[model samples]
Target chain A: METGTAAHDDAAREPVWTGLPPGLLKMRRLLLVVWLGLLTVVLGALLNLFAGPAWAAFALLPLALIVWGWVLLGRNWRSWRYAERADDLLISRGVLWHHETIVPYGRMQLVEVTSGPVERHFGLASVQLHTAAAATDATIPGLVPAEAERLRDRLTELGEARSAGL
Target chain B: MTTPGAEKDVPEAAEVVREQVPVVERRLHPVTPLRRAWAPVAVIIGWAVHDPNQAQEQLTRLTTITLLIGLAVFVPAAGLYGFLTWWFTHFSVTDTELRIRTGLLFRRTAHIRLERIQAVDVTQPLLARVAGVAKLKLDVVGTDKKDELAFLGEGEARALRAELLARAAGFAPETVHDVGEAPSQQLLHVPAGVLAVSLVLTGATWGSLAAALVVPPLLWLATHSVWTVLATALPLLGAAGASSVGRFVGEYDWTLGESPDGLRIDHGLLDRTHETVPPGRVQTVRIVEPLLWRRRGWVRVELDVAGSSNSVLVPVAPREIAESVVARVLPGVTVPPLPALSRPPRRAHWCVPLWWRGYGLAVTDTVFAARHGLLRRSLALVPHAKVQSVRLKQGPWERFWRLAEVHVDTGANGTVTARLRDAEEAAELLREQAERSRTGRRDARPDRWMA
Candidate 1:
């Protein structure tokens, strides 16, 4: 029950209404689990070749972490929520220990849209908002390219108008 | 946060006309050519050093041929290239903006509005100092990018800085330069003993880590493990000490004084650094009292300005001096009133025994202040208008105990704010802060730049 840095909320603290693309969760899980599976294979081979079955026990730690993470990633994905308010944007994420980041529309200096090869393959992109204060800066991941562009333009327009008031 | 030059009555077309009229257009100093040719000179030296035998043997021929070739090819080419770069790099100050144009081919220009200049940094690096030039970096309020004018004459840099700051404060620029009088006060100085102690503390941390990692092998191989350990540790400790001493020397002779434009600081042992925190740009201020200096009542005052870091207002000083600095730099904002803070919940005793009792929060009409720490007490002052966001948090145990904490942010990077305890209270506090932040920014007076 680690307490994360989160902003004000009612006692119930209902989940935010917005979410990432539905396909994003499955993609993230596959990417992580595939890598972990490969590591398990490599570790098992090395341990058996060098130190035999007794030393092979060392492989359990990473294997346990991978298994735990693969199962909990669904919760982590569900945790990510972003809400666009009239004056600011709220980004809340983290599974066991929840964290929330709030970035004001007025404080936004630059809104960038970026997509890596993997994300592009999945037809997704991320929008990053840069601010003078690093901590308040926020990024929204797993939006479609068109949606990312729309958000960037909309945010940039709002930023210019409200900047004088930040 | 008010937009500069965008206040009620100014027309957009008037600004366009103002942009066409330049107040001062000056090329960088003559030494800029030589400075720009550093890469070529370094390459030439590397060629000479690569093979001393061949270089020295044919010294006369090499000298004549290279000199002729250098005169014919490299000198003219490097000189022309450097000269072109220098010619292209010109800065102009307009009534409402500062325009810097550079680049030969791409032809890029950066125009910073007069009121948007958040912080002005005057830095004299080694080469620039030797060449009698300094660099000026203008940090804008909302943008992370800084507009810089490199290699202005030192006097010119100071005059420009003073003028820019004065202009931002809505004063006659000429008056700031002509006043010739030194500023009002000098607050604190890092004594030699403090500097030595700071060095030792830094050295001990770095030195011990290095010794721990490096000594084991030496101990295993050497006949006398203790001597080997000592031998390894001495050099590591000396290196760390020397490095810290060098940094202290670079930032030495630090002096802060009151000026019409803002609270000005003139310091830096080797290369001078002149920084001004204009009237309203100061975002957050923190007062810290280290444990070692507890009995002596020494403390440090650090602050953050929008769009800039390097906010060390005071390295170390007496508590009185720290308070005085806070008074001068951050006017109007005051210490937190203790009455606002209720007793900490019973659960806080274990994790934050020292801090629990001293922790406090108070909101005045214009500002909110948070106080924490026991022996090393720290008080953070942030105005309602400056608040960027607010947070309420509860650790697992805190949740079990129905305790919560509230965090307020002001867009000042690396600022620290304690969360409030008691869930309902924390929620109420956050909501109140958010509303205050909105109304506060709406009705707040414009900053120097925006005014």
Candidate 2:
């Protein structure tokens, strides 16, 4: 057959898109403010000591950038969402530039759930799906620990069920 | 190639019979140790020939008697080590899998399932060829490291390769004995003169040669110095020349042939290699036509197979020959012609000002094709069944132009990112490609390839 109708495009059958937990947003924003705030305060004090309070006002520039980045991160987080389908996984994200990757369940080689020291502190984890091709950049970030493990297990199970040879 | 009627009718029974055969463990040829030892010695002799006087002075400095004694002891020690390694390494083929046991102190066993084997390659280095032995490399699925059987008798290697392929294809063990050499018909042979000319005519060679010739003279004029010309230009010229010479020697006597087992490519002057690429295993095929070669209507064809990357199907051939070879390699697939390709919108030129017109995408029933590049134009065709994933990307500039790129990714070689399509069209292509991939996979040949 040269062409066929989209079998899985029905709106009723489409799965709900899952967005990252708001706790991740709070943790990330807190981290940004703490790091940038420390830098700005220290740099401003140094400038006040060496170059006067007038030069200390220059430190406000970084503070302004931090504020802008804080808002940008929220938008990027909102843009990041994933939806599991009958045979493939869809990950759509990006603010200025949009990217939507569809990795078939049959192609998944490994599914991993990882939590770094900071993420562990924040009680947040990320799920990564790897395929034979590196171009399938499928990573769902900032999920609750339980949700990440659940997703990993479910994906691993589905991957084994539909596993196809390369 | 005997396709026995019994096996064809009853694949299940054939599998049962195939699994019952157990081959005994076999060591490499006895000459393997000597060949391995001689390989390094040959390299040393070649190096010593370059600076014989320095070698002589170094020998004299060491005292000839002592040097002779050291060589006498060292040669035997290396030989013993090689012998030990050879003795420990053994390979056996079972009905279900091929097992290679290697290592001296710590034991290691590599088990490659018969059905998971993508290809079997036979390669012979100069020393191996001289010793009438060849190395067998098994390209197994799901493994980045290749399993190699080093230094088997040339004929035995071929026989073993054929036997393995036959079993992998689901033939009954009995019928496999009838498949001797698997008679292949020669499709094309590249002449030495043509290969040499093609190498010299490439844009890279021309640019490098121009640099070597012009840079030295320009420096001599600007600095009024002969030392600068000698110091900089000679090495650049030699390095540039060496690459072309190496390719020429490596790709000498290039031959493309077709056999029941797969498409066979035999090449190399010093280290001969015989590569078999099954049509089903090819992930993508790229046909490249450089600007210089366009007038001659010649193009280079390359295939990205499942386990191996960037395997050259033909060094250079007529466009028709390339097209036919590609069609042969990818059976039942039709590559859309260049003129029928869908080009990007004219206003999308803002992103790629010079080459926007060159970018094109074509989606056929079985293949997703992308055409791009101004100087070295290329058309890459990926069979939908071989597609691993689909991605749609739109950058800020592309967003400004309402353009997006649809990337069709294959297993290993690279992604085909067709850029500067309308945003909606790009999304549609991504969906269509993913859908096609699913359907293609369903209709593809089974993992038991021969069956």
Candidate 3:
């Protein structure tokens, strides 16, 4: 009931493609999680040696966290999608519960395209859109660098036309 | 429903009188002299009253000290007052605009277009009341600072409000009407029951009685003297109680009236204040019903204006009355139905089950009883917007679980928040909401003009 009949009218709306390209390297960013986990476990063991029993319990928390990260990596590897609409863009992800976010071109306050050192090696970039209200902003990570730049230019053009009362 | 044509009873052009131009009359603030002298005088008096046994020996020393302090205070007060009196006397108003020049050490001049004026507020302190002068504050939309013209005759305040209102209505020549006619409607006065309840809640009444009866006896028992703590403490308590009573008595006859120009609020005890706020300047309207007032169905209405936020137009009225006033003042904004008191979400309620999958992180909450303010049981939702920047947090134990915590930073003063919870359905919900908000349309609706 939440979705209107117009939602099913795919021809009237823009084309939506599920899943990111294989070349996108979002999986490499998972290393940051591994580095943080190693630091916590080392620090926890050091504290357990110096302090008493309470410190040992605190140190064991990081070991338990690494297992949680592995589960998320397995789930996200199967369930992420990116779609482009006529007036807006959407990024949908989630294995069990699905979530779809739409970002209209007109309301985009700022669009930033960034490439990290690791991402540059892989020729991938991330796009973030900022809005006046803190809520409802969007970020799409791991796209081909050239594609990211093209999307940014298109969004800027649409934003200017909307502000002029078009 | 009446047709638009039937409702249109336009008056003849000749009969419509033009609005009078507002004239700015300024004078020095009467309280400046008293405020400057109060500190020095209090210091001298305390010195003189101390050590009665050494009074004779320290007479010369005390006199020298008092004179030095008095001169230090008197010189600045005299210089400032002289400069203010000269600078403030030069305000003027034409048919189109108002201009004022004021300052002592740093000279400053300000100009405000009549068309952009949103509201005019007149405030009078205790000294101003005796001197028959009040401070006028004019608010304009989109401006950071308000135009202030301090110290004007009480009659001038009313005249200025009338002139400004008339100008806003676009009055024309060729028609003359009496300035004082029967007011279109009566002002709504604060109810007696609410006032009585407010007094009881203040706790000043009980404290006053306790000080008068119990303190003297307690002093007599402790130090074998009636005049020890009782003499000092009782008088201070009485003075504070009396002032509280005075304020209540002063605000007893508060009333707000709807006039052709805008909303006119008149209230005061020792120093009466008259305020006029036009419709256009209101940025946001908030209607609050504190948990305590739910049974009485009373609500407090506050309007966020451009210049003034503290001096909120607080109209304590019934819930329905508050809603209607808001609808009239701010059109187009949706007014959600009044939430029932009993139906508020409890811990682990039904909505939790549907949304729990999205909540990837463990949520810890601390609940306390609602205080006396408008909102009760505060709920902080750390969504994607709050994520100032996101960071992946992991612990040693989490490495085994293969789970990472997504820390989202929500910026201050905006709905964006930093959420530090386990990555689950909650994190997904936040990301989706943030994406949707980024594309939502910005608010640019035009405000309603009184004319």
Write down the worst ten-residue block by lDDT for model 3 chain B. Answer: B364-373
DockQ of each: 0.28, 0.70, 0.08
Per-candidate TM equals 0.70, 0.88, 0.50
Query: In model 1, what lDDT does residue B15 have?
Result: 53
Task: Give the candidates in order of DockQ, highest first.
Answer: 2, 1, 3
The C-alpha interface RMSD of every prediction is 2.6, 1.1, 9.3
lDDT against the true structure, each candidate: 0.70, 0.83, 0.52
lDDT by residue for model 3 (A1-166), tens: 1224376446224446656555552454366466757877787778878996577677656666656766666566556666655545666665544444455555466789998987787778888876433554467777888888987887777666643110
Candidate 1, B1-451: lDDT as tens digits: 1123442354565455455544667897777787777667778779887887787776766556677876788777888888898898888776557788888898878888877766788888876888799988887754433357777888878778866766666543324355343355556667766655654444344655576567756675765677667767677666655566665775577777776566677677777888776666778888776566666666667788877757788766777767777866666655553476455666766656656887777777777777887655677888777877665556666666666677776766644465536667776676567667656777655765434
TM-score of chain A of each: 0.77, 0.91, 0.61
Give me the runs in candidate 2 sitting further than 4 Å from their true place.
Answer: A1-9, A12-15, B1-23, B38-66, B141-146, B215-235
Per-residue lDDT of model 2, residues A6-105, tens digit only: 7546731465688989978998899999999999999999999999989999999879979998999999999999987767788999988899998888
Candidate 2: residue pairs that collide: none
Candidate 1: residue B434 Cα off by (Å): 3.2
Q: What residue runs in model 3 are displaced by over 4 Å at the alpha carbon?
A: A1-166, B1-101, B107-118, B140-147, B163-184, B191-194, B197-250, B280-306, B310-451
